[model samples]
Target: MEERTRAYLRGRFGDYYRRTELTPPPGANEREWGFIPWTSGPGTTMVRHRSLLDLGSIEDFLARKRPRHVYFSAGRYDEPSASSMSEKGWRSSDLVFDLDADHLPSVTLGEDSYAEMLAKCKDALLRLLDFLEDDFGFEDLTIVFSGGRGYHVHVRDAGIQGLEREARREVVDYVRGIGLDIDEIQTKEMRGNTPARVIEKDGGWGSRIHQRLTALSDDLKRMDNEEALGRLSEIEGVGDKTAKTILGAVSADQDVEGYTENEEVEINYEAISAGNIELGGVGMRKLIDAIAEETVSAENAPIDEPVTTDTNRLIRLPGSLHGGSGLAVRRIDRSDLADFDPLVDAVPETFVGHEISVEVTDGGTVELRGDSFTVEEGVHSVPEYLGVFLMARGRAEKGQE
Candidate 1:
């Protein structure tokens, strides 16, 4: 790390340690805390079997050592220690969901920049939160900004604590919409001489399909025939023939006539006939299923699967500083998350208004307090928040402008 970066970390570690919550994992007398005292250190120094009775000791230790990184295990233990899990007899751990922009391929951070990447991850995090709370009916959950490029949702529901690794993997899969079968989700209805159509059902993936299809229908209406066909074909299972059929059906100037007793609907096939190409019940069903699958795939949260699956994972302590970004790992209220800007909200009070000079080592753009600026290769005077941020990222070094 740069000298100034190290100095900033050293100065702020005490306040961070004091403010950060040091809650041990459930049912544990001691929690294992790990620290990286220096950036060039061989590896993390494990400080285990620490009694949680005194927060003062941990604070004092942090003030003296001034670690570049701080972390604590999710797993609770009878006797928490790094040397042996057998000795500890692992009791239980909170189910952790790590939503990271680094894992998401949708956004290229090099071009989109960190702010955009963070926004993408935050949106995914909110969706995951909805899935956990409204879908899975989980209530005791904690949300934390990971201090770097993402967020962490910690499920503290007592029922979920003892879930095995495979069980946890299932939860991760559900959130990611992995291996969801569209065939099983869509409701098939036989309507007169026309082909069977798949209608969206009430819950689970069905509701998602319905929502996406509704939006897609509106969007398709605005596009020309070629554009509409191209858009439909972009869906995973939608082929050229299926896309053309969907485009024809959507473009046809005919309202869904009426529903039968079974809610099987009828469409005017005459209106949909663009040349000799006609859509049958089976073909229409296939197109709808394909669109549903595409919707589900797009809606899947870009979370790090391994983090959620690992029962014994160690996560960054909340209110601690992230070594890579010099931002505080902040505990966020679910209500305030919509307006929370991590760059502005997670900055430490110590560096809030202070000014510092730094030399840009890496060329890129950075956003601070809603202002965007290009990072040129040279020294420049910046606020303490941005200065420490760039230095921590190794993008800038301490120097006179």
Candidate 2:
């Protein structure tokens, strides 16, 4: 099982390492070990005296692998006091490195969907990459496997000292954006008989932007295909139908510049790519406006009538979300506050910490990033309790049975 997990980690995170974490002895509370003074800076060393994997040899692991980034993360939660796993709930789904508790949705979907959960994992990472590349521009992000079922992605370019609290906050929002998309995962309303292809299934909106950016950050490698699509489908203002329209244009390889905002939208990637420099805003706008209207057909006019690619550029749009190039947001700063350690004093701070985030780029492509590695459980948690319950009954009710 561990080996399979390791293989998946290596495949998902191009640059990363797997390390076991040590903790306090059998009976000692993690608090007994004392704290590692952290005002948030690069190269602040952490201590690990006991664990599934040893931390004492971490330097050797890094030296051997020569990885660019080292991220820590995990899927299970251990006993709150000692950082032990024996007494905790077996979490099927993971929260990963979102320590701040900000952006933690109140939704309790313990059984509604597993595919949805996995897709969310991917989208969360996609959003993270978007922010990391656009906002920080930090390069060579690598993830680490900190044992257990979690993972982390480390930005080797910026150590702890390099990452300020504000930057951490941005990361948290990015992650939340990914998770927030859970509200829109493949609902009944999204499927349709008319669902021909929107964007090419493999190469869609996010992929288009991802390919456009050179020096793709290691942070982006963590995103899987399903995650990217989840994000494309959940672009806030770009409802299901419209998001598909925009994605189709991108898949068709249309240049974003040629896209005009009007009642209808149109685009022809082959035309734009051919250097039809004359195809300016007016032409682009007309195409965009006519995109969704069935009434606006080739009968009125066709680019072929003028110049082969000149007026042939109109690509259709959905009547909804993709109506324009505009995007929408409910809370900008709300997501930004996600990663702050509001309860730093309460948790042990030991970690297998990997995470995901969201970022906006290219005015339309919302990117998600998965902190591509793992960190173990810290020494402690503040609330003094983790939600757990066990009950027994003499009789089984109809639904309970």
Candidate 3:
């Protein structure tokens, strides 16, 4: 960082420490806190056996060290040292979920790409939230925008505090939809002269399957018969004849019989027999498997599995600045999440009114607040927030004007 940038950051930290509310992790006195102070040459330094007595103590520490980044352990410890986990005598920990857009398929890192990637990340976070709340019944959750590429969900349910590594992995698997048996979730039944419809039961993964299918049905309805048939035929076991029959049945809103009251709705299987589509249970299984794959792919949130499973994970402290992004790690209220714009909302108020000149070293277009600007190899006067963000990214230098 340049001298001017460093000075600006230090000044911001001074204000932040005074104004920002800092909440120590549960069992804070027993957990280790890590800091990457501006004076620290390159890496973070872990401060152990050092407990903050109150918010004033936290502010005092920040004023003294002026760390570029702050983090605390997910796990509580008796020893609170980095030397050995076994010696630390680990206690209960929050179940942490890290959802990063970079982990999602086709995400690229650049200013031009950030908006789309952020949207993708928001979608993933919402899905994960649904899974956590509706499926797992977890109510005590904290959501934070990581101030860079993703969000974090911290589950602090008392009942889940004692969950072991394997149990944690099971929760991760459920969120990722890994090792889910499609057959167990969906069953196929034959109606006279109808296509074999995959019937989704109520509750569990069944609800998700139903949601996906309903969306798919709406999309399929928008397409012409031939288009619907073509898309359906792309599925592994769905032949042209079967696809046509299925499309016809779906288009006609044909309903299947034998489904219990508990079942949401039955897919019509009469289309298969009507079209003389001869296939065994294996073929039916394949079609259902295809639907399952589609549903999972569309709905599953991409999260760092290791982060969630690791018992001793250290998560970024909310309200601290992300060193790489120069943005505040913001704690988001559950109700405000849908409207929270990280790029705009996570910016420090200290950077709001000030404007700085910077020379773009790497060319790209970036949108800040609501305005978009094309960045190229030249000096530009921009909001202090943008200047700091560009400087942190190593894409811009302090411009000599």
Q: Which candidate number maximizes lDDT?
A: 3
Sort every candidate by lDDT, greatest first.
Answer: 3, 1, 2
Better of 1 and 3 by lDDT: 3
Clashing pairs in 1: 195-281, 196-281
- Name model 2 segments beyond 4 Å from true: 1-119, 126-156, 170-401
- Of 1 and 3, which scores higher on TM-score? 3
Per-residue CA lDDT of model 3 for 1-401, tens digit only, reads: 56666666667677766777677666777776667666524444554433344223666787667777788878887777546778878888899999988888647665427888988899899999989988889999999999888999999999988889999999988888899886566555565566544545466776676665556566655665556557678876677655544544433344322222233333443333222223333444445556677777777767899998888887898888887778899999999998999878988876788788888888787777767878888889988888878887778877764
* Candidate 3: 10-residue stretch with minimal lDDT: 269-278
In order, the Cα lDDT scores of the candidates are 0.70, 0.26, 0.72
Q: Mind giving the per-residue lDDT tens digits that candidate 1 earns over 1-401? A: 65565665577666666665454345434565566665544344555444344333556666666677777777786666646767767788889989888888678856877988999888888888878987789998889999998999889898988998999988988878888776566554444556543544566666777666666766755665566667767777777666555544543342222211233233233222211112444445565666656766677776898888887777887767887788888889989999999978998876777678888889678887777878788988888788878887878877853
Who wins the TM-score comparison? 3
| Runs of candidate 3 exceeding 4 Å displacement | 39-56, 106-112, 186-200, 214-231, 241-280, 399-401
> How far off is model 2, as Cα RMSD?
24.2
Count the clashes in each prediction. 2, 85, 10
